[model samples]
Target chain A: MSESPSQPAQRRTALDALHRTLGATMTDFAGWDMPLRYASEREEHQAVRTRAGLFDLSHMGEITVTGPQAGEVLDYALVGHLSALAVGRARYTMICAADGGIVDDLIVYRLGDQEFMVVANASNAQVVLDAVTGRAARFDAAVRDDRDAYALLAVQGPESPGILKSLTDADLDGLKYYAGLPGTVAGVPALIARTGYTGEDGFELFVAPADAERLWQALTGAGADKGLVPCGLSCRDTLRLEAGMPLYGHELTTALTPFDAGLGRVVKFDKPGDFVGREALTAAAEKAAATPPRKLVGLVAQGRRVPRAGYPVTDASGAVVGEVTSGAPSPTLGVPIAMAYVDAALAAPGSAGVAVDIRGAQEPHEVVALPFYKRER
Target chain B: MSINPEQLRYSKEHEWLSAPEAGVATVGITSHAADALGDVVFVQLPEVGATVSAGETCGELESTKSVSDLYSPVSGEVTEVNQDVVDDPSLVNSAPFEGGWLFKVRESAEGADLLTAAEYDAFIAG
Candidate 1:
């Protein structure tokens, strides 16, 4: 029988049934039917900071680059030196257009000498795949979009190690940050990576789509005492925001280059051969180093009034300077914080006269450095 | 949590107003609006002595999700604005009818369009 026409045609993750049974508040996110929150967003945000939180990140795109020239192709496609990356290590990089605009920020994991996996944002997965494929036309590497073949899960926070120790025989202790290795986790063949977006010591397990539900069950069962709660996109957003991570659609967009986002370091101008956007990025980076036009900074509001996205950021005389990209009432800081792009002259932390136009009132705010919160470890 | 006191008059905008005594009425958002707004974080109320018209936007209710306009339910001059709820906005979500009252208005004319509790419940239900 045909489905009702009014029903939303959203792609379901492998853990869809599990989320539904847990009473998750389901919502459509980037064409994927995902959970917005399993409980109170504040409670979930606190759980990831204090204890541990499990996340179903299956919607994120995973692309595999293989062949002898894989690293070379990555070097050509992204703004990082991927060829020199040691095996099993990962690098945070970005794909840019020819004009030096950011296409998407990505995490490229060097699995082996000739194999690398690129993890792209959910909304930009297809674009990344097409860009990488087009960039590899002159190289010997073969780019394959392997998104549907894997289910990604993350166990994040201070209690992550203890919670995962009971489920895997892999050397969880030896796994370093920004690294991943193929290993058995919870008796399932998986790529156990010590990487996460939460700015906490954590593991991201990449396994076959069919093994996802089993892995989730095992992790929850093993982590029952470690305060492992099923977290949704809401807390994940705030956690990454606290960490000052740039989300693709928010902090990093196609119109803005890495240099404009205070991430010029990710662009390796010294890398050999002509990479995409090298000349423009070189000029942009040089200009930014000399005198940046604008800079992204953190803002902390005094009152409870939240400075939401698209809110205008103003100067002392109430002159519009920039705009807020991402904001929320910080569950960790117990106040409202935001990331905004402001004029370079006033980008320094504690700069005077920064305020967010919340509705009609200009709420006073203090400019601060990025990453509002960080783990002690 | 969805209590609609029988004695209180409600507006289609989900505000409740106490029956006028000496032309003064206590006004607040109903439980239905509170539940819809989830957790209230901030509230901006009309200044005392400011004249207000029924069904007009006078203040705002900021929640975590988004900001919404608080419509004045009756035409009158504002008498008292609730400072207690303004100090702690969650009262709007907790005790929306009691400690969470927004402002009092001395009515020039009773809100003829205000609904009875039964009608208000039916309106929200629909």
Candidate 2:
């Protein structure tokens, strides 16, 4: 816990004390002292799949773009057609460098006719802030860094809605997926979004930092009898991996384009006017349509050995074909699963001859669809 | 079962070896190692008849988050591996000293580096 002379101190969330009190094993994540797990990561993962899991997502960055041309600015700044996004709705989008390299994948929430909020990964917050600010210079809009202004908490799982219903009077049933509304939850003003990274029916509540503890306690109390557990980043990683969602530093990176990661759908070519990376993304989209150099695919180990991140994937002849980006022993599947970017020819779901180099041994694996698990409606 | 530190020799690599009976000793990772490694998911043990050297890697224990090498505290011939542990790796976390005993080795030599429980405790405390 001692900081080295050259290293800066890790930031602590508003509920840092609460997490420690609950016996969370804290770890450094994206320069923040976040909980890696409260107890067993496997148990936490299973709870999220079966019951409900609460998450402290305050470390995620929130940048607000407001004013007359806010939508116009975002349309020119990100890959998505944000100008067309209706108020109260959210869109999964990405901001790429001029060369089409992914800067970061983002969730843009249109809060008003002329106001939008861009949520970026914690590690890429400042980068995204600078990118959006620079892109908004000529527009009649303002980009504000609201990272420290809010604390985000997520209640995710099948039982999430029932748990949240006890604390919030918001129209939980009418709140469509990817939509948000300003409301009061447990007497605290908040933005309740029906959005989540975990592939579950859940809600993410964004509230003032000062009100975070109260809201968390209220939700915990309400969810106590519903088998809700405070989960940590360890289970979060495995949960998202099982859902086939891409993580910023892992599945998405500056070296890869949206098309390269098989996320070409996030780029809206029909959006009016030129945006950042538009030309390059257009070419990338065309190239992807013809023959993608690498495509992201799911991998299930045929053995017990886990194929972890950065492990090399090989073909039958021992030629390296790809590398694992995110992996874990899926608590749901009871097997090791991973997502990897492999050569296009080997990306098909049932393609044979795929193996992961676990240490020096090439353990055989089967290529499958992107998501290893999906919630049953 | 409960660990009697006085009856066991510990390795700096976080393994615990019991006092030899007829030159055969039971080996498993210490609870501290198990807790640090998190939930153990998979294990690879040296096969029966395989010769392992003191302070050398004899197997691997893969946790959900990461993997660690299992080192033999004594140079010996592997007599048997606990198949129950091989079938259920979580025993390595739940019962590291009992049901999780990885293997029994007939020792030819014990490593001079092995520590008493007190010394091992002090070593890990640092």
Candidate 3:
């Protein structure tokens, strides 16, 4: 799947029955009974393209950090500088190990001067919590796992704003990308963030699971004329892959450093003091300037053949150069595209030719820049 | 969502085979299989001349996130393969019975022992 394996198949949310009714190809992803797709991937993909789509992202992890030094703790624990973030702003940051390996990439939301929320990928919920909890405890800051009480839903696509605005009394006009605010939907309290992974203008709503169904139904019923459709993981993968988004287990992992995954900007070395992995990050930066590990680059298959995950990457001489970490046939681009970590020399765009061992035969490919597709919608 | 066709014999793996009305048996994956796979992006069936036995792996069908083996329900020498389906695999999802058909074989009675649609459903339930 696009995310991590959920531990112990946690409780199902209000959308379980709806998914079954819609005939979703249900699977265990991050311990949630999520939909892969309703019926046709083409139709689902086009819905968000032409109109709006709703997603049940309740399986994601939400952790709250509140203390006098909460900002100071995350500033050191996460790779990005958090001290400059004003209230209601969210920054995508990575938590790195002492050796400069990524533990998880999460969205850090500054609620107030001393209170913050970090939403992590479901599979890495425990990993991020353990890392942050351990670090926050050093400063006596409380790290609470609010995942159990929270249900996350994404209202995505071009028509999302209009459909969702009618249901909420809160003003949704001023909210920009990566912006968040306390809002209400169907008279239930929730946190609305103007961010999504589908390369569309959408919002991520965090509300109680008890109210999830009502809000989802109200939005879906209200947005029906506006072309809003319920999306599953199937279309979700294609959408994010088209947007050049990095998945947890594939692009980012506990073993891979942020620098190796084309995330050098997220690592803040000039934060004025030593943070977690600070020395190693500085050292990795210096080492990378000399010899960067096989760099991550975009791949475009020559034919209709899709380059899959874990497929071996080879050079013109047929020698194994690296491996494809994540790939998919983009429904948006109508072409096969992928992302792989190849030797830094081969990582240069258009400079090298490679082949992916697709199924049994090798298919030719060209390295392109990240984000194989981007649309105004 | 529905049985592929009555005349065609079904396999537990969800393939359908019809004996050649004139010595040419046809083969295609069932509609259920195509739907379960979500979307049919890539199909790798044997060449038109490849010999295949009943219940043997003949080709592969890959979706956005999975790879499944395509098994033949009849034993015969492949006489024709649906190149049209290979070019546009979504046909398999939308038209698994006719346009999405994978390959055809010369008439072989050995392939006739495959399950019927009802029996195949029972096998999946079990």
| TM-score (chain B) of candidate 3 | 0.89
**Docking quality (DockQ) for each candidate:** 0.39, 0.79, 0.64
In terms of lDDT, the poorest run of 10 residues in model 3 chain A is: A1-10
Clashes of 3: 3
Which portions of model 2 miss their true places by more than 4 Å?
Answer: B1-4
Ranking of all candidate structures by their lDDT, best first: 2, 1, 3
Per-residue CA lDDT of model 3 for B14-105, tens digit only, reads 88887577888888988778888878888988987888888889988878877789988888789988999889988899899989999988
Tens digits of per-residue lDDT for model 2, A156-189: 9999999988887889999999999999999999
> What is candidate 1's CA lDDT for residue B4?
98
Evaluate candidate 2 and give its CAPRI docking class based on DockQ. medium
TM-score result, candidate 2? 0.97
How many angstroms is residue A74 displaced in model 2 relative to the true structure, after the best TM-score fit? 0.8
Q: In order, what lDDT does every prediction score?
A: 0.90, 0.93, 0.84
Error of 1 at B95 (Å): 5.3
Reference interface contacts recovered per candidate:
0.26, 0.74, 0.58
Per-candidate RMSD vs. true structure?
A: 3.2, 1.7, 3.1
User: Per-residue lDDT for A95-132 in model 1, tens only?
Assistant: 99999999999999999999999999999999999999
Ranked by TM-score, top first = 2, 3, 1
Question: lDDT per residue, candidate 3, A1-377, as tens digits?
Answer: 24446544445767888788877777778777788787777678889877999899988899999998888889878888887898999999999999999888899999888889999998899889988988876785788998887888898888999998988987799887898999898787889899888888889999998898888889888898998888987888888888888999998887878877878889988885568998888888887778878888889988777788899888888778888988877777777889998887777788566888887677899988887877763
Model 3, runs deviating above 4 Å: A1-10, B1-4, B109-113
